[model samples]
Target: MTTEPFLAPVTTPAERREWILRLLTGTQRVDRIRRLRESIILSLLFLSALISVATTIGIIYTLSIETFHFFQRVSLIDFLTDTQWTPLFTEKHFGIWPLLTATLLVSAIAMLVALPLGLLAAIGLSEYASPRLASIVKPILEILAGVPTVVYGYFALLFVTPLLKRFIPQLEVFNALSAGLVMGIMILPLVASLSEDAMRAVPQSLREGAYALGATKLEVVWRVVVPSSLSGIVAASILAISRAIGETMIVAIAMGQVPRLTLNPLVAMETMTAYIVQVSLGDTPHGSLEYQTIFAVGTALFLITMVLNLLSYRFLQRFREVYE
Candidate 1:
């Protein structure tokens, strides 16, 4: 049986013209309503995108204004050159390098631990594990992402430092090594999740082609899948490093407040974020140089993270694979 039309063809010419006119009018009304809805949705999305850009501009302005004030009182030369960072002390050394060094040291340690483990985990989950196994393990591993940074700090100071002390007797109670190692663990989930998504996005045909050429699973993954996904992997690594650099509580609690220009991970050190937290916690008078110190450190932190993001975007563009 065939479905009947809502309106049968009219026998009269005048009736047919009337029916055609009504249909066209109804269609036009529907098209107008659809266009109006699309315009509203598009405008809302454009406004939403502007919010982030506006927020970033506001942050840059705030940091720049305060940092300018800080540099007026404290010489830029001293801030860059001096060995010690004793801004709150009676002697008042304004060297920024010590805190920067500590920040880099911790970030370096975190990457060292996170990159290899996270990449390997991503590879295993994407290439080797069964779908069911990958589904179970990925979520379990990502549970680390939800764990609070404060908890990680407590764990570092209470558990990790002591654990390291057993093997390295010289480890300080509040040290960079424990803090960095814990930060690495905190970053692992982010790296692994992003990387696994990237690798999984690769076309299955590429893998099949490799197999037809007698390439083993390992060879296909390393040579084809990994190279195709290199952009995403690098992006994930950059994001993880930026997260490590901006982390405050974990480094503050575990890495101590001493601003020493030393590379020794076994000793106590201070990061830019840790120093900012310390100043914020204290009752430093508003408009004073000590108070302004937070803004200056924040400026530096913002610039570093921004550079990393830019670099990530550059890498993504450079190695992006356009699969047909």
Candidate 2:
């Protein structure tokens, strides 16, 4: 004879109902726990976004308040039309043109140098270079970006200026040319990396189609790849320009603090960033007009950067090519 195990069956309706409720409760509990975790993750992401927004708002507010005070003391017409920028001097003339022109000139030179070289590098990396070569070269190229601006500043002052002086005897020791050239070198990696990524994002099918039409490698790259990636390239250039515009240390060290409204790159000049740095060195007393000038300059810089970003966004939206 074998021993049999007894099992309890839910014979009563109440017992069956109780069993069903227990199973439902377990599933509901699991669902509730999942929802809670999801809510926590969502909250964290929202907080991160909020923090960024808050920081931007805070900066804008600070700039705005101080800028308002500055404008109250100095008329807008004088600020815009005045050729001299001698805020720190006893004979104060509050024209922003000198700083503005110097900023533009340096940025223009940087763009001239960086754009062509970077575009060429990007093209070579994306269309011509082997994967092994690209992998090795790209990292080495990006290493330039990691080098400090202060180091670049000293290099421009100590090395590049002296070297250029040999070729061009007219070049000033502390001039816009050396600073601009070094600044361009500093920003080249940004353009190359970004433009290469954009070029690489272009669909391979487009290149194949161009090749099928008996196009050469150069033709395919210039016509198919470059056109498709134009938005990204332009965006990268704009970003690099903004970087050059806002550059402080390199320009400050290499380009002398003489605020002059001249297009001559061989002459020493002061940029808006350089001006801000000059003021921020703690020599200017707090609550003074000299101190307030930094805020006004900052507001202008903020506006310029914001405009560039907006233009980049608009261009990307208008010209971005979508691939299936």
Global lDDT of each candidate: 0.92, 0.91
RMSD per candidate (Å) reads 4.3, 3.0
Worst 10 residues of 2 by lDDT: 1-10
Q: Candidate 1, after superposition: displacement of residue 197 in Å?
A: 1.6
RMSD in angstroms, candidate 1? 4.3
TM-score of 1: 0.86
Q: What TM-score goes with each of the models?
A: 0.86, 0.90
Model 2 per-residue lDDT at 179: 92
Runs in model 1 lying further than 4 Å from the true structure: 1-45, 317-321
* Number of the top-ranking candidate, with TM-score as the measure: 2
Per-residue CA lDDT of model 2 for 109-189, tens digit only, reads: 988889999999999998899989999999999999999999999999999999999999999978999999999999999
In candidate 2, which residue pairs get closer than 3 Å at backbone N, Cα or C atoms, i.e. clash? none
Cα error, residue 114 of model 2, in Å, equals: 0.2
